[model samples]
Target: MARDYNFWVYIVTNEHESVLYVGMTNDLARRISEHRAGEIPGFTADYRCTKLIYYEHCTDVQDAIAREKQLKKWSRSKKVALIASLNPRWKDLAPEILGE
Candidate 1:
């Protein structure tokens, strides 16, 4: 039997850390790369929201999507608090994703 992979719900922030973007994907690394490369277009690309600050793993895509939507509905302060809970300094987690 093939191993099942996880889906991810992630939050990315702009350079100035003024904006937050929530998204869900099965391949977090590739999705982050696309965001970094400006391939996503619209809000993410335009806002330069390439810093991966927070992420949660889910076995189901629906769960990941639901989490993403829930996070999106949260206030900015709430989102920031959530990120801070996991990453106190809000460091860029892109390298962590790549095992750097």
Candidate 2:
């Protein structure tokens, strides 16, 4: 059986925590690849924020969008706390997501 495409709200950050990028996507891997490859010329690529520090899954795209907007409106410290809660060390979570 084919897998269903779930929506996701994710946060990426630079190594020094100087930059943060919040986004929503249906394909996390491809979106992360684009960021890594600098395919999208914007804040993330400019700051080299490719680390997948945090992400939340949603069954509905609208819900994901709402969450993304909510996160974007939060303070930097709150965002950091959210990330740290699930990823205290701020480690790259891509490997775990991909089961590598």
Best by lDDT: 1
What's model 2's TM-score?
0.90
Per-residue error for 8 in candidate 2, Å, reads 0.5
Q: What are the lDDT figures for the candidates, one per model?
A: 0.92, 0.88
Q: lDDT (0-100) at residue 13 of candidate 2?
A: 84
Candidate 2 pairs with clashing backbones? none
User: Model 1: clashing residue pairs?
Assistant: none
In candidate 2, what residue range of length 10 has the lowest lDDT sum? 91-100
Q: List all candidate RMSDs to the true structure.
A: 1.4, 2.4
lDDT of 2 at 82: 95
Q: What's model 2's lDDT at 6?
A: 97
Q: How accurate is candidate 2 locally (lDDT)?
A: 0.88
- Summed over model 1, clashes come to 0
lDDT of 1 by residue, 1-100 (tens): 8777799999999999999999999999999999989999899999999999999999877788789999999999999899999999999999989777
Q: Evaluate model 1: give its lDDT.
A: 0.92
**Model 2 regions more than 4 Å off:** 1-5
Clashes of 2: 0
